[model samples]
Target: MTRRLSLFGATGSVGQSTLDLVRRDREAWRVGVLTANCDVQELARLAIEFRPDVAVVADESCYGYLKAALAGQGIECAAGAAALVEAAERRADLVMAAIVGTAGLAPTMTALAAGHDVALANKEALVSAGELMTAAARASGATILPVDSEHNAIFQCLAGGRIDQVRRIILTASGGPFRTMSAADMAAVTPAQAVAHPNWSMGAKISVDSATMMNKGLELIEAHHLFPVGLDRIEILVHPQSVIHSLVEYIDCSTLAQLGSPDMRIPIASALAWPQRMATPCAPLDLAAISRLDFEAPDEERFPATALCRAAIAAGGARPAQLNAANEVAVAAFLAGRISFPAIVDTVRRVVDAAEPAAPSSLQDIFSVDTASRAAALRFVEQYEHA
Candidate 1:
């Protein structure tokens, strides 16, 4: 039977990649809904092409444009966060939660509560509310398939093997644009330069996160929850080549690594067809052409985001939520030219350090932590007053 799919964040990098896979086998799957943050024109175009049952624009102001565009297309149109959450919980067998940042949490929780198998591409959801989401998944009998390349690689390598025999889950990073830059040079880095990642083409927020190596840090929090592994068992290695997605080490000294070209579609395809492999149009890996693979330890002094993330994970509870929120605010400030690239981590560090620590027992608690962290982050930016 064809799976009915609802894709949140339809215009984003992850959402668009999911669309590419679904579009290839249109007859094999049905598009139940497509939701976007704004991009009404692009969302309308997708609605026209896919003819989904529903089209949602997360920005309420863009609802009229979307409604008018889909007037004759027989697609239902709605807007705002409420509509986005409703779309997620609507009649769909599978939900792709791709909305970036904390905005994705509510809708993703809704999807889980509605008992839909989630192809989770939003790392923030897991990082911010790991305990709550995992509990929801257990209670609702919902399955969460990891869509991030690193998590997906580790998932594939494990094959649901005995966790007790696992030694460590080692995640590989491409180290972004400033991997080799000195601490002083990173302070002068421009937003344009930071967003220009060497390996992956992503949205600005994630691109900036990549530049700071905080993407790996966020992934570490994600790994801790997704794999239920301790902080000691998760390791991050800087592999600038981006060939080895991730690795799983067994207690028997055996290591399994997943290799591929830097393509989101591969992981997307893996999530879409779990326990069964399908042919994706991702570029084939040419190991023969590239004979050598290099790996190095990430420099904590140069990129402090990774260190801050590790500390957050060690702190537990709402710490990850604070870390994620603070990082997002700092990255946005840097992107807006209000702060230097190096200040991104500094701002996050200050915010996380100053916040009142809370042991988050529920989803609401995580949201509370996130809000406080963002506010604290803004305060740090104000105090620094970087032009």
Candidate 2:
């Protein structure tokens, strides 16, 4: 049986990887919708090849180009944020919510509300609106399959087990490229250096998040929502090898882990074939060739983003949303050369600290907090830029 599929952020790293897996087993999926944010040409190229029922670009201005490119291809093309949400509501057996940042929240929620199974790769959706997103899933009977490698690992580890039996969920980090760098040395790092992850290939924003260990922090918050494990029981370990994706410990003192090469497709494939297995072109993990694996505690002093995220989730309410918003702004600033690498977390810390705690009850409230946080983060970024 062929599963109908809708893929958001079709031009991104995760989207490309998902498409790669789909390409290998083309007969297993019927492409319905594919979306990207302003990459009209690439989106058109993918739409033409995959021949999705419709292609959407989030940026409204790019609609003309996208439409023209897809003209006579028998694939409909649309643009703007509304189209993204509309596409998510389309009939599909599975929705791959791969759009990065908070922009993905609405469409993801739309899919869940429509009772579609969502393969979630966008951490910001859960990080920013965990309660609401989960509530929507519960009300609509939609399943949110974790697509992030760590959460997916825990998902696999907990198979046939109850959450109550779980004692701890250990998420592994690659420690990025600056695991051993001193604070002083890190302060002088460039965006290019920060994005050069040691083990995984990713977009610039997330790559920088790994450099500051913020990605792990965001994952921590994401894990809390996904696994329902107490935030206190969730821990982070710096595993430089990137072989062990994550671990879950049982109350009976047994630990279960999912090990794979540092390939995004591994997790994407996991979600794409939930309760079943799929084959990928990735090389088999050779334990002998990569003989040793090492683990260490994360250093919060040098990379305080992880700790900040813990505090935000602990505080609950608007803090995690604020933290995610500020971090997104700060990351954009760093990438644009508007602030120093160290200032990225510093700006996030300041903005999150200064934000007023409030429980966002609706998507509107979350966006309000996100908007306010971004403004505050930009102000802090400017202060750092001049200093």
Candidate 3:
């Protein structure tokens, strides 16, 4: 029987990669639902291509355009967050939680609560509500699969091994666009320059996160939640090649690594077929052609995003949500030319440092921290703009 799937963020990089794989096996897969935030054209195109039972656009303003685009196509049309949540609980065997930021939390949790297996590509969802998410997964008996390359690698390596026998998991970083830039040079980098990742093509926000190593920091927090391990057990290594995705060190002093070309499809396909490997569209790694491998420690002094991420994870509760919100606001300001590129980390640090950690007892608690954090970040931007 073909497994039914619901894809959220159906227009983003991860969503597109997932659709590519699903389209290849249309005979063995059924596209139950597809959703996009505001990309009416793309959503309409996907609706035609996948022929899902329902198509949802999160932005209410784009509903008419999307609805008209799918007129007479016999597919159900819905709008806004309610539509997304409704899609989350529909007849989907698997849910791809690929929406970019913290905004993905609600619908993702909705899917988990409804007992659908989740292929999670959005690290912010896990970062923001790891405890709540995992608890819901446990209560509902739903599986939470990791779609990030680093976490996916660790998940693959941990197969058939006892968790207690694991020593450490080392997550590899591309060192992003600023690996070699001096601190003075980094301070003047424009948004375009920062998003220009040398090794991989990704969305702009994620690209900027990579440049500042905040992506790695968020992954660090994600690792803490995904694996039953302490923060000290997770190490970040700068591998400019992007060949070795991640490594798992065993208690017996052996290290196992997952290597591949810089392609998101490899990890996405792996998550889609857990306990069974499938053909990935990603190019095979050529060890003979690539003769060298390099590694370095992330500089906490220059790229303070790493330190800020660590502090947020250590603080726990709503701190991670606050960190994510502050970073998002700060990055947006930087991208809009309202702040220097380097000030992204500074703004996040100041906001998180000034904010008090709150115990998030419910989803509202998480949103409360998120709102206050954004406010703090905006206030920081205003002060900096006037300074």
Candidate 4:
């Protein structure tokens, strides 16, 4: 059976990884659509090769470039936000919601509203709008498969187990490149050092998030939404090996875990061929060859982003959006060398503290708060620059 598929953020790391898998087995999927934020060249290249039914670039200014690149190729080319949402509305068996940040939220919602099963890679879509997203999925009868490694690991472990018998879920982290660095060392670290992830290769924004342990914080929120678990029941363990993806505890006090090499394709392949297995060209995990796995507690003093996020989770409503929005702004500032690395979390704290978060009545409400929070966080960045 050929499954119809659409990919949002076709030029991103996850999207590229996904393409690598799908392109190998072209007969298995009908490429319904492919969309990229602004990379017209890459978008056109993928379109020419894979030949999706439709191609969209979020940067409307590049529409002419993309269209000219795909001329006479029999693929429809579109540009701008409306086209992205309209593409999501196209009929498909599954949609890959991999558009990185909050920009993915609307198209993800559109896919769910259209009742397509979504393989979600956008952490912000769940972190900032979990309640709304889950509610919409419930109403639309759409399934959301977690593509993040931790959540995907827990998902596999929880299979054949009842939710009631589950005790807690422990998510492991590589702790980025600063697990052992002192507070003073982190304060003086540059963007180059912060983005040097020890285990994972990711985009700059996500790499920065990992350095501050904010990615783990964001993933904690995502897990809470994905699983029927309380915020306090979720724990983060710093496992530098990145071998054990995640663990789930049952009533018997035994823990079940999913182990794999640090490869994104493993989980993504699992999501795409769910309820069935697919062969991926990834190396098998060899436990004996890899000496031993070390585990320890994440230092809250050095990485307080998680602690701050815990507060926002407890606060509920629009606070998570505020926290995520602020962090994105602060990360951009740090990446641009306008602020110190420590100022990333500090700026997030200041903005989250000042926001008067309230219950979001609609998706637009979430957007309003997100916009306001971004402005507030930028002000913090300016403060740090002038200080």
CA lDDT, every prediction?
Answer: 0.90, 0.93, 0.90, 0.92
TM-score of 2: 0.99
Which stretches in model 1 have alpha-carbon errors above 4 Å?
none
Instruction: Compose the digit string of candidate 2's lDDT tens values, residues 106-136.
Output: 9999999999999999999899999999999
**Model 4 worst lDDT window (10 residues):** 159-168
> For every candidate structure, what is the RMSD over all alpha carbons to the true structure, in angstroms?
1.2, 0.8, 1.0, 0.8
Q: Considering summed lDDT, which 10 consecutive residues are worst modelled in model 1? A: 349-358
Q: Give me candidate 4's TM-score against the actual structure.
A: 0.99
Residues 1-387 of candidate 1: C-alpha lDDT, one tens digit per residue = 688999998999999999999888887789998999889999999999998999999899999999888887789999999988888888887899999999999999999988899999999999999888988889999999999999999999897467778899999999999888888788798999999999899989999999999999999999988897678999999999999999999988889999999999999999998868878888999999989899999888787788888888888888889989998899999989888888888888888878656798877888888988998999888877844
- lDDT tens string, model 3, 182-250? 999998899999989999888888999999999999999999899977888988998999999999889
Tell how far residue 36 is off in model 4, in angstroms.
Answer: 0.8
Q: What's the lDDT for residue 359 in model 4?
A: 92
Winning model by lDDT: 2
Q: Which stretches of candidate 4 lie over 4 Å from their true place?
A: none
Model 2's lDDT to the true fold? 0.93
The per-residue C-alpha lDDT of model 1 at residue 171 equals 95
Which pairs of residues have clashing backbones in candidate 1?
A: none
Clashing pairs in 2: none
